[model samples]
Target: MIKVGVVGGTGYTGVELLRLLALHPGVQLEAVTSRGEAGTPVADLFPNLRGHVDLDFSEPDPERLAACELVFFATPNGIAMKMTESLLNAGVKVIDLAADFRLKDPALWEAWYGMPHACPGLLEEAVYGLPEVNRKSIADARLVANPGCYPTAVQLGFMPLLEYEGIDLSCLIADCKSGVSGAGRKAAVGTLLAETSESFKAYGVPGHRHLPEIRQGLETVSGQQVGLTFVPHLTPMIRGIHATLYLQLDDPDLDLQSLFEARYRDEPFVDVLPAGSHPETRSVKGANHCRLAVHRAPASNVVVVLSVIDNLVKGAAGQALQNMNIMFGLDEAAGLRGIALLP
Candidate 1:
């Protein structure tokens, strides 16, 4: 069995990993760390995991974590890099749900995260854990940097279009909406019920930290530098993301629907809806699926694609577990075959 350790077990993604990993037949959840909640029964703090996980939250001791077969760092951005080398040296695999090892350039990471990467050397070794694009890398990786929520949605939404050498890379626009949990578990006044409830507005306009990450993923697939206009909105709800991407195709004859269908035919979680279909975020709520639909303008060169996913699942923790399963040579969908929660 794969013995797993989770750092920062009280956060959204950490609990999410706990939720999914607890049900995994091939996994044995070993250690869960949270300094504030140390010595408390994890299920008592969560209540939701009552009988499923009886583990206790403990202090984040790197030495204890290094003994596990695999460790998941669901802590904030800077936490993973500091401890990654120790875990890797002990032959322990890692899947980081933070932004620490995602970007290739340490300077750019410092610019957005406001901290210098503690282990810049490992940046080359940390694989970008998008199952669709980097499956092979993830399978052989010792460290996997799970993509951000917005980047995951935006990249999945635009990947097919970007890959077509016939498509124009100059006019890519992404208008994505995400739930408040994407902000993290911190008690921010803006994410409070009084402020977010019944209020719908876009926060990051001209630039967002996720823009560079999305661009990096597109460049990986397209094999060219891409200039994109990415705008992210905060939804009043708490669990999903919907991204509407608008692109202009250089080849008007390229069939958008066929392109998506063929590209994602073998991918398990990505569903390509038929023309004129609008996939709702609620349909994919609580699941790791990315429901997508593609449409093209009959009169213009613009193509619109709608993509939806549960931010906490496909966007964060669930995806992290999926990467873990792949890294261990287990079935890619193991412990992640949950159906979407529909109302």
Candidate 2:
């Protein structure tokens, strides 16, 4: 069994990771860390995992974490970089669910995250953990940088268009909305039920942090810099991300539906819905799936693609487990087979 340790097991992403890992047939839960909640039973904090996970929240200890074969950092951005080097040196494969190791350039990372990268030397070696794009690399990587929630949905939505030359890369737009959980399991005035409920508004119009990461992933696929206008909004829900992507197509006669379907044909997690279908965020809630649909008007050069995913699942923890499966040569769907939760 793959011994696993999770750091910062108190947040939404952390708890999600614990929930999924507990059901994984190939995994053995080793340690779960939370500095503030150390000594608290994991189930006491999250009643959902009461019967499955019997471990208590422990202090973030490098030596203890090093003993595990793989360690997942579900903590804030800066925390992972501080402890990753020690874990890596101990032969522990590390997967960071934060932005710490996602960006290759240290300066760009520091610019957005507002802190110096603790281990910039490892930047080039850290593989971006989007299984659809970097599956092979993730399998061989000692360190994997999991993509952010917004980037995951947006990139998967725009990928099929960006790969084909008929689509204009210079003018791409991602109008995305996510549930309050994307803000993380925290106490914030903006995410309060009273504030977010019965309201719909956009934020981060100037430049969200996920912008660079999304651009970087798209640019890599298209082999050129892309002009992208990414705007994120907060919805009155608890989970899921819905990204409506707009792209200018040079060829009006191109079969976009076939293109998207063929592009994701082999990807188990990306679902391309039937033509004319609009995917809902709830359809992918609690599941590791990105459902997409492609549409266009007659004689129109514009294409609209709708993408939906559970922000905490395909966006964060579930994807982390997918990477773990790849890293260990286990079935990619081993622990991620849970269906989306419905009303």
Candidate 3:
């Protein structure tokens, strides 16, 4: 079993990572760090992992973390970059589930995230951890920058279009909605139940931090400059992301359904639904799956694609585990085969 440690274990994504790694057959759980909650039983805070995980929230001791073969940083942005270089030098692989190393340009990252990057040189070395696009690179990467939740949903919905011809790449629009949990477990009046529940409103239309990340990924995939309007909404729900992508196409005979299916045919986590089907976020809740469906507007040149994923699963923690499995040459789906939770 590979030894692993988690840097932050108090937030939503942190607990989700702990939940998966605890029961993983190939993982030997090590230290879980929380400066605020140090010495607290892991199960006491999560409850779901009461019987599975036996560790406690300890201070982030670099020496203990170095003993593990791999470490995951579930801390907020600006936390991982401060310590990743030391862990890498200690011969430990690091996967950051935050925005610390996701953007290649340190300037852009600083502008978006509101902080100057501590380790600008490592930006080029950190591989963007989207298994579908960087499977080969992730296997050999010592540092990985996990994709953001909205970017994961939007990018997956738009990927197949980039592969085919005759689709307008200039006017892409992603109308994505995410649950309140996407706001993180931190206490905030904006995400309180009284404010979010029984309401629906778009928050980051003009500029969201994920906008540049999504554009960068799409441009990398298409090998050309991409013009995109990515608007993210805060939904009342607590666990899913639904991305409705719009595109313009002149090819009347193009088989979008077949194209999506063919693109994701070999992918284990992307489920391309049948033609005319609309994927639901609940269908992928608690599973590391992106369920997608494609369609053409009747008598119009507009093409629409719907993508759904559990915000905390495929969107964050579950995808992090998927990357770790690949990095270790283990089964790609190891410890990630759980069925989606349903009502």
Question: All models: lDDT?
Answer: 0.91, 0.94, 0.94
Q: What is the C-alpha lDDT profile of model 2 across 86-152, one tens digit per residue?
A: 8999999999999999999999999998999999999999999999999999999999999999999
**Superposed Cα deviation of residue 325, candidate 2 (Å):** 0.4
Candidate 2, residue 292: Cα displacement in angstroms equals 0.2
For model 2, the local distance difference test gives 0.94
- What TM-score fits each model? 0.98, 0.99, 0.99
Q: Write the per-residue lDDT of candidate 1 for residues 1-343, one digit (tens) a residue.
A: 9999999999888888899999998999889999999999999989889999998999988788987999999998899899989899999999999889989999999998898889999999999999999999899999999999999998999998877888778878999899999888998899999999999999888678888889999998999988799988998999899999998887878878999999999999999999889999999888989999999877998888999999999999889989998999999999999998868
Model 3, range 87-147, lDDT digits (tens) per residue?
A: 9999999999999999999999989999999999999999999999999999999999999
Give the higher-TM-score candidate: 1 or 3: 3
Candidate 3 Cα misplacement greater than 4 A, ranges: none
Worst 10 contiguous positions by lDDT, candidate 1: 247-256
What is the Cα-based lDDT of residue 58 in candidate 2? 97
